[model samples]
Target: MSRHIAGDMQRYNVRPNCISPFAWSRMVGAIPTDTPEQQARVEKLKKLGTKQIAPLASDAAADVTAQIFAVHGNEIFLMGQSRPIRGMHTSAGWTLETIAGRVLPAMKQNLYPLESSNIVFS
Candidate 1:
């Protein structure tokens, strides 16, 4: 989306960029909890949320327009960068059986966190 916008608006001298913001909001109230322990954990999380502040619209817009600002490109401020952690290679080539038996096991130890989970929110 940011790239598309940047390309489309380039002719007009509009520098469209993207920023992944870490913010705290009333959305925390929507977390569902059943038991007292669960409710307490939710409350704790909600309290922690207060430390994260959302970007101000006027400030963010101005900073992005300035180009001298840090988040001028597709930048993430509070988060870390994506890096390749592990991989597996085979000189003899691989079949489904080999992938399931050999490569999978070899790569399993270096798999990304939550690689086994099926929880894909996107």
Candidate 2:
């Protein structure tokens, strides 16, 4: 539930909003299939990302390349550094267990009224 900006685009100063994470909705660089553990897991999965978020891409490339998808409850957020990122809000409260186990981690920093740069929302 965080909207952060890091890795793959280390040239920028934006931090991954894991405190709120933002990343490419599509693939940007070579998909890191470096470790056996990662390859084993990727070998079985089809789509790299979720249905809601847009695939992340790299500016250094010509067109949309690989996709890096994200899943956040009912929706997904796309990763485009040049543009503003967005996320959907929950409609109801949840159980304490759910909050402790699930909800709190995804709780996003207020990203509204996109004027401020500290929390460049998505």
Candidate 3:
């Protein structure tokens, strides 16, 4: 979306960017952790999330645009756009059963951990 907007507005020199912030706002405070391990993880995350997000004005002033930025505490992390990490191709187009039983299992190492589905609000 940011790239599209920046491209469309390039003639006007308007810049657009995306912010992915890790902050301990009320929403983070509201997260419920069930186990000690989960709680510990949450607490550690809280440290990284302790600072408030910086305003986009500074980023604009710095002339940074059309990029994804991860704000962690006082740090400003400029990230490249997302791209595919890996791909798998089969001569026979995959069927539901094959994908579920073979392809997905092969990709298990790349999957993110999902300890508690209830932790995420959406």
Q: Which candidate has the highest lDDT of all?
A: 3
What local distance difference test score does each model get? Answer: 0.49, 0.39, 0.69
Cα lDDT, model 2, residue 51: 34
- Report model 1's TM-score to 2 decimal places: 0.39
**TM-scores, all models, native as reference:** 0.39, 0.20, 0.53
Tens-place lDDT per residue, model 2, 3-113, is 333444445543333211222233423346688965644443333334333222234322332233334434454444334454334567667776666655655553344
RMSD each, Å: 8.9, 15.6, 6.2
The weakest ten consecutive residues by lDDT in model 2 span 15-24
Which candidate do you rate higher for lDDT, 2 or 3?
A: 3
For candidate 3, the per-residue lDDT at 94 reads 88
Q: After superposition, how far is residue 83 of candidate 2 from its true place, in Å?
A: 21
Q: How well is each residue in 14-109 modelled by candidate 1, as lDDT tens digits?
A: 764434332324665665678886686565544343222335234545434322222212333432434567767889898999999987887888
Off by over 4 Å in 2: 1-29, 48-50, 54-122
Give me the overall lDDT of model 1: 0.49
Error of 1 at 7 (Å): 12
Q: What number of clashing residue pairs does each candidate have, in the order they appear?
A: 0, 26, 0
